[model samples]
Target chain A: MNITSYTARAPQLVQALEALAQRADNQDSASTLFHELSGITVLVAKKFTNDRTADGMHDAFHLTVGCISLGISQAGIADSNEAKLSFLLQHGAEYVFQMGFRHIKELSALPYAAYVSDFDNDAFIQQRNLKAIFLEICNADPVSVWTGDAVYQNELLDRKRNRKIIDCAKWLRKNNSNGLVKDSELDANAAISIAVIFAVSGDGCIVARTGQRELENLIARARETRPDVEVNWNDFLKKIPPEFQPILRERMEELRGTIVKKIFSKTKIKTVLTELQDHYAGSEQDIDYS
Target chain B: MSENINLPAIRQQVTELVLAGSPEHAEDAINETAEKFGDLAVVEVLNTLEPHVASLHLSAFDGGKMSLATLLIPPKAWAESLAYFAATWDEDWIEDEPEVLAESLFAHIHGVVFGTDDEERRAELLNEALATDWGTTAFAVLFSTAAEEIIEIANDIHNLGAHRSGRTTSDHDVIPLVLEIARTNEEAWDRVLFEIFPDWKPGENELHTRSEDDGDDHEDEEEREHEYAIGRTTKELLLRLRKQVPSKSSGPAKTGGRPSLGEDIFS
Candidate 1:
């Protein structure tokens, strides 16, 4: 089965990974094993939460098996190879490892690996030195350097808590200010903006406070400001249906009178996101918002 | 009396011609008889031929032969003859194996509705037919037929059905027929949709008239509500269809003659 199918069906695997991550620095007999497993989880999660391209998934899969093997070796497991494989398969590690192995085999134009030993020496290790592994991947495939750069850049930003959503909101606000008048462009950016806001604040309470009228006013202002160019005002206004218009309008009116902080204020953020989703939804744009 | 042609022989010949899959010849024979023996003699011949016409079992080969022959008869006489035929159309027995008879009957009604130049008379006959159970049955059969067959005369069909506006028989019954045409014939489809939803046009007076008529009749409020609901449903269906079936885009027509190869090479 595919890695995605395995991930979905096997909740135990995720729990075990999380448990290992929690005690990642423990000085017990399985300290190295725990760290290795934790390292693999972090790498895979980073690949998942950032760039979810096939290549990224393939890389995640490879690193997963490498660290899993390292963990088993460090723990001094006396089980037979077949038994070990069966245990790994049950735990959801085998799916990713198999896919990764096939991807590598196809790329190198080699026959299928008969056993774990058929894999290169670099495929297993005592511990995952993430930096060294990334550098090695870049050396083997120069195109992967960009992913390495992104990973390092995100590592710096990961230190801050609850900042990504606000940063994304600010970015969207800047984009909106720069005349998102064209229907297609407006819809795409708006969907992304809603998704970011939704991620930060659940239940859409923030948006309910901001209201529809303010967004309507914003669209009117944009159209009025640029009369020379064809800004589809009707197209923009049609984002929210007649049913939701009254309630949204009232909320926006309430938001306008308050001295609310911009991105941090849940009400203001929701107000913006709601307008964007409504507009995007009306246009039937299919970009992933969540 | 001796100079008059044999009406019985003419009737036999006309029947033979129609049964022989040659309604064109039957029409000619009837016209020749009228010209030679006068309208009275031709009428008597048709009277004598009535029994033969009644007994005709129209097969797929001769589905519309009798109707085509009826086109040769005078409109009033044709109408009277058709009335008798329709009264005797045993739907119970015919329904068992109704295809050929239904085709013939539908063709007869179609001719009456369209073959004559008189619009008022056509409307009267159509209204009469629609009011009767037999007529609605014939219409249902014809509606099913019209959907499968490509009726080139959609405009005439549209006009015939359009005459029933505000009548006891709902014009909404013709929706299936119009939609069927719309599926195959783009121009007719556009014509029908435009007729139904004239409000789509800017400054349309028809929709304004509807608004003005609203609340004028308190008793008809329920009927008006039902009609409004139907109208909404029709509009929604049409809009959905418009989304599904993209209209063919026509580019600007090129009227000029072909260009010569004598241009300044790079200019």
Candidate 2:
């Protein structure tokens, strides 16, 4: 009926949802629990809209509940892999914050003269702090919260680590043909696939050495934030479409062959033209040239 | 029994009567002359006064063959008087059969009492009568009395019409007078009187008798004063509820970690 009534009711509802979430967390069925929690959050939102209070505390409470509910829902949907779920939770948190900000903007325009004045800024600050805590939890050590044992053994990690180095070396050899590749787009494209390989290797150094501007930037950012963090890059890369791997490998090989041949020829320009002609000639015989 | 007065014929006669008399004594003389036709059916009085009266008129239908004397008075009164006569008097005095008496009573009142030119006003009166909490018996008596009055007026005016030159009076001159009387009484008395007593058209004096009361207007003003307050309270309640509800995200950030990068690259 009024703001006081709504405020009084909100906590009890939130507590119920939290209890359900806790059960879900313990049971490792957060997804089902998250849906139930979302339903409760939606009810709270509907009641908040029905009551139409412009106070910031009221708005913040509803927003915070909605955000956390959404974050948990997203986390529930994510792969069991801690890294991926962390990513999803991060995105969900961002989305919730944006939603809350929009609500704040709308609340500011309420026709009641005292609406904005009655807002509780402290409550909003507390909500912000809670969000920071959530993000910290998401970014924390995956092993600490990870429920399952590591799927990638050291043998696979070593093999992936070696394969990544060889792939990077091959890409570097192809791109540097004629002494320099010069074209940033071509170099970056080659470097990206190579970086994925390094990511799969669990060796951040390969990413560091790729020398592609974007790859370098990623490495720097990752190091600064989480230098010692051991990311199973191969597991991360497994999330990518399987079809992309073959295409990436084929392109890298083709580029490497052309660059190596171009570098060896006495007449760099003439050799490139001859190689291009030969490649096209072979394609024409196999392909319909009409 | 007095001669049966046809309404048109009576109207012609009353016109002549009114034309021959001074306006001051015309109303009284018309009333006196109409009373003389008390032995005639109420329609006779109505028909006789048609010329002198502008708005009111009446008609009648046959009610089989009753003793002609029994049909002369207003049908309602005539029916009661006949019933009294049949109960008290011997069968030899009842020349007409009981069926004939019933038919005569029905015909006299059905055609003469209810019939009038002002159908709208009559309908309004009927609606008012139906809405009132009067008992069925009381309502029936009132309806019969009103009908009888109309028939008597019609006959009286018909009888009085004999004195005038045949010229129809304007209905505007009579309608307001009847309406004024009808407005004052809760029952349909004015309609009944107009139908039975056509010579008497309402004058300025009758219209002046009614007064207006201001109590309803004051109540309306009070309701208007609180209307805004109620509206404001409703909005306030809704506003408070809205504040309690959760808010949604506005839009994706232009630059953010994974999502923005993914969106930009993919989209």
- Go through the candidates in order and give each one's DockQ: 0.00, 0.01
Writing each residue's lDDT as its tens digit, candidate 1 over A114-147 gives: 1112223444331233334333322212122123
Q: Quote the positional error of residue B74 for candidate 2 in Å.
A: 80
Candidate 2 lDDT, tens digit per residue, A119-181? 334577545534433322222121122201121122234444444444443454354323432
Residue by residue across B1-267, what tens digits does model 1's lDDT show?
A: 853558778887877776677656676777787778777776676655553252231121233344333433443444334334433444354445455555565555555555555655555545544444334334444443333121223333445543332222334333434443333344544443344343334222211113334557866755554343212222232223223221222322222222211211101
Give the poorly placed runs of model 2, Cα more than 4 Å off. Answer: A1-66, A70-180, A184-290, B1-267
What are the C-alpha RMSDs, in order, of all predicted structures? Answer: 34.6, 32.1
Give the top-scoring candidate (lDDT): 1
User: Per-residue error at A180 for model 1, in Å?
Assistant: 99
TM-score for all models, in order of appearance: 0.22, 0.15
Interface RMSD of each: 31.0, 12.2
